[model samples]
Target: MNQHPAARLTWYAVLLVLALVFSFPLYWMAVNSLQPLFTGMTWFPVRPTLENFRLAFTLQPYWTFFRNSCILALISVGIPIFTSFFSAFAFARLKAKLKGVLFMVILSTMMIPPTVTQIPQLVLFKQYGLLGTYWPWIIGGLGGSPFIIFLYRQFFMNVPKELDEAARIDGCSTFAIIWRIYMPISIPVVATAAIMSFNTSWGGDYLAPFMFLQERQYPLSTQLMQVGYILPSSPNVDLFQVKQAALLIFVLPILIVFLFGQRFLISGIMTGAIKS
Candidate 1:
């Protein structure tokens, strides 16, 4: 049943090429980050240096941005996960009127463009005096995404109903049953959701933070725009290199989280997909 040697070698060659092609952007980021002060767009650096990275921190309050991102990410991820778990448990197990219709409506919202409600949400938050503060971001975290809820719902459905019965026999509440039994066995899905939430709430998110937070409260992502501090006194500096350095720094934490949780993430998605 094994393929011929030449065919297998050709397959591997194709895979290698695809991998390199997909990785080119990240490779470019690394190359640019380590590039010397004056290099422009390049496939390879003639004299790679650490100065770009050195300046990435000096040009901005990179650590403060990092700290704010961590806080926002944690708050955003935590609230959604907590809410989604209970909501999913209810949908998957507990009987309710119009449950399927409600679930469908939730899923349907994903088809609508988020921008449609952006102004309305902005006006509502402003009325509450949350404009130009982190409160709006924190408040927005309360509404769990439908996709995450669906993932947990699928995973919850796969758990044995007998567990719930046994928990009930022991006088445990439905919430207790979920926390004690289902969640313990759902580590993969939990990790997958956590990683997804963290990544979504982290870098590359300009809209929500930009609307709610001032420049002083900006995360590393927004701070990247004010990259003018890299060489304020010098007009002839290659800003492309400095911006690339900021981009790499902004991406590193999520990259680390993904690498660490990749196994769990894949397994969880696969399990949820199959179960649903």
Candidate 2:
């Protein structure tokens, strides 16, 4: 069943258009970040400079925010991945009577909107005297997240029970079985959860760290908002270029993560699609 040349050409055209549509914003950001401030708005930058990037770091503690964001993302993703791996393995392999019910309760949490819990969470953190600290974000991640657990459980379910039985017969404890057998096979799903968790904690703008931390302790996203978007302009400041440069910095880490882990990310996504 060979396709006609005209039909293939049309499909290629459609894909090319979609690619351009998705890529234009990123392209524009890169271009504008290099442009001179207060210049006329254009699709392409006329004259470019690195001054905006220089000014961005000079105006604020950009490296501090970057390090803080990396720490937060690492903690947030690392906690969920290891915890969810074990929880998912237990739920998928160990046939306990209450397993179904417990899994249902976990799934139920996903139905509730996070916004509804924000005030209560804020008060709870405040009561614990953990406000203006990293504790809130760290604690949230340390608890195995409902969504990541679900993802891992689904993937684990697709694994053959025979492997678990074999490992058990070989005198492997539950943790050993999970570590020596399932974990190796579960790399795709783990990568998926890691990428998702990292992005969620890295890019999230509300609650968690935001409500718990003050100005100096703010995450990269919040700091970007404050210094890049909300701050009042001084008479001598070139606000436009500064803001553009800040936006560029904000997106850089995410782009790097995606570029580096794209293969693993794709494998993770496809692993879930496999049927038992």
Candidate 3:
């Protein structure tokens, strides 16, 4: 079953090349953020400074943007995860006449582009006087993500039905079964949902915040796009360089989450895939 040594070497060589290609932008960003402002691009900087980091905060209300981002991310991730867990459990464990049909309908929603709904949603929010508040984002997440529910349902269905029967015989309530048994074993799935949701909420949906919220309420994702970082003392500094610095900080949390939870994310997906 083993491949020839030359073939294995070639495969690894290809992977190494691809890895470098994919990672080069991150490397370039780091290099650019530290390099002297307005200098020509180089593989490495000769006189890097921490001044860009300082400028990133001073030029704007970066901390306020950061706090807003965190608040929205938490709301965006939490409500859906909580709601999805139970909804997934119903699809996975309960028997109903139209369960499959219902699940398919929910799955179909995933194919609907968010862009198609934006105008209608914006009007709805405005009619409700929800614009300029966090309610637009909050209400959007209450339905939970179909994809996360699908992930949870797949993982839940893979568990033997006998376990549920056993718990029932021991007088475990339905809620108890989920809390004491399913949740403990589904750590990987939880981590997977969390990382996915966090990324989407934290940086993915700029249009929602931009359209619905005030300028002061903008998150890091939206605020980073503002074109007023030029300092009077250092008007020569490239705006792109300042953004690079802010972007590095902007991306750091997502990077850290994935780096640590990638193992769980892979495990959750693979486990779900094995059964369905």
What tens-digit string does per-residue lDDT give for candidate 3 at 197-255?
99988879788888889999999988877554675678765566777888999999999
lDDT of 2 by residue, 63-163 (tens): 88888788788888888788877788788778789899999999999999888888898999899998987777677766689988888888888888898
Global CA lDDT computed for model 3: 0.89
User: Model 1, 79-177: lDDT tens per residue?
Assistant: 888788888888999999999999999899889876788889889988888887767756666777788899999998887788889889999987788
- Residue 111's lDDT in candidate 1: 92
Better of 1 and 3 by TM-score: 3
Q: What is the C-alpha lDDT of each candidate?
A: 0.82, 0.80, 0.89
* Candidate 2 positional error at 99, Å: 1.9
Cα lDDT, model 1, residue 76: 79
Worst window of 10 by summed lDDT in candidate 1 = 222-231
- What TM-score should be assigned to candidate 3? 0.94
